[model samples]
Target: MKLRALLLGILLTSPVATYGAGGNSVVTVNPPIPAPDWTLPAIQNAKGNLSMSDFRGKITYVDFWASWCGPCRLSLPALNALNSQFADDPVQFLAISIDVVEEDAWDFLKRYSVDYPVVIDTEGDIARTFAVDGMPSGYLLDGQGRVREIHIGFKRGDELKLAESIKRLLSDLVTSEVDET
Candidate 1:
């Protein structure tokens, strides 16, 4: 009876052996991708309806902002700089406005003279999807569309760090592809 009880206790407490830790263990999170098959209404500059799926092959930065937000205004130059820096690359910088009206957003964009693609989220649908709780939130998506980084507030040196991270991810992707081939 003692032996049986001891064996039962061990069986109950022991960790089960797992293949790669579990059947559904995450090896890695690629980067933020657009939500799966997410088709949004046509944004201002898009030729057709836009979805996160459209940018599947490139690294993407999605900025959730409102024109009235001071921090959002301040971050424009940095975002523009990033856009300029990666002008020739496959990375895309998208600014999504959470403004209630298109004119308010367009006015701000014109005032800023921002050069990157701007997507209007008039209904705040996209912002809600990303669980955005603050203005001027930035999300960096890897080339594979996984969320690689998320920033809620602006900081002085964030742009530089963001650029470096994207470059590093791009390099890693290239290196890995070469290795795989």
Candidate 2:
């Protein structure tokens, strides 16, 4: 279809940075690429600005959400629970909102209180950088700052799968650290 062609054109034309042993060259992006760096203000904390690099040594679950996305209503609270579960572990959860009207997001937060840290991204630059094409997209980053998984949408049973992925990544981190030592 025309829509498919348009998307294909965009993908084929997209600029992808490539690294070489001797120098550098531009190449098409492959999967599991390094996530783009971004810094945003804390939406509900006194922590000031939070940069992606700050989570270098931790497993980061970056959830991109919006007030209008119904799945986010469920996803955020669930993420809070996951955050608590991983409280003692080296894991971090960042709920970044793309709500154009930040007041709306604030109101939603008022109704649904969460314990996890939140970042207000009204400009959506971070979401664009992540190429988030759906509501409630989640990016799982390993300790070394590589994108391990890109999850889209949310449903009733996705929680366990996410938790499993987190556990696997945590184990992988431990193994890698031991090997390095």
Candidate 3:
């Protein structure tokens, strides 16, 4: 974990505000690419492992966060509420903590409880695969696991914007299903 944390610090040297949406910026991937497959252990090992493929055929919102990241403190709770609003929908939300130390993540979660699945990327493999460049980054993936939108940083009202995007995607899914039938 220590080594992974060191490497991440070196790799994530870019300015946070340059790309993506939220309070900072949100960039739509020009040509959506398939999200890589990954299986990560649940935070504190309290639950079974989770994989990217598990949410297949659903609108997956994967959030990369850490207890130490300031923006993440805000993003998690907001996302939790958004997840509840779409509780009956085909949307699935997953939060992955990139904290080097496992305890830090637990401490943060104690105060800001979330309902969605939470996992810990102890080896940092998941974050590297997603090319996470900033703290509290989010990837909105389509049913087929394509990365449709990227969100970086979090600010007040950002959750509203995210909710709108999710609704648009859900509508798209409904349209496609109707066409198929």
TM-score of each: 0.76, 0.81, 0.86
Misplaced by over 4 Å in model 3 are: 1-23, 44-46
Top candidate by TM-score: 3
lDDT for each candidate structure: 0.67, 0.75, 0.81
How would you encode candidate 3's per-residue C-alpha lDDT over 92-165 as one tens digit per residue? 99999988888988899998889888999978887877778788889999999987777878897888988988
Error of 1 at 83 (Å): 0.8
- In angstroms, how far off is 148's CA in candidate 3? 0.4
What TM-score does structure 1 among the candidates reach? 0.76
Best by lDDT: 3
**Cα-based RMSD of the predictions, in order?**
12.9, 9.5, 5.4
Clashes of each: 6, 0, 5
Residue-level lDDT for 86 in candidate 2: 91
Pitting candidate 1 against candidate 2, the one with the higher lDDT is: 2
Point out where model 2 deviates above 4 Å. Answer: 1-31
Ranking by TM-score: 3, 2, 1
Give candidate 1 regions above 4 Å deviation.
Answer: 1-37, 41-45
Model 2, range 1-181, lDDT digits (tens) per residue? 3333432343346455323332212223234456667889888743899888988899998888888888887888888888899999999998888988889888888976688778888888787777666778787888877776666677765667778888998998889989989
lDDT of 2 at 42: 84
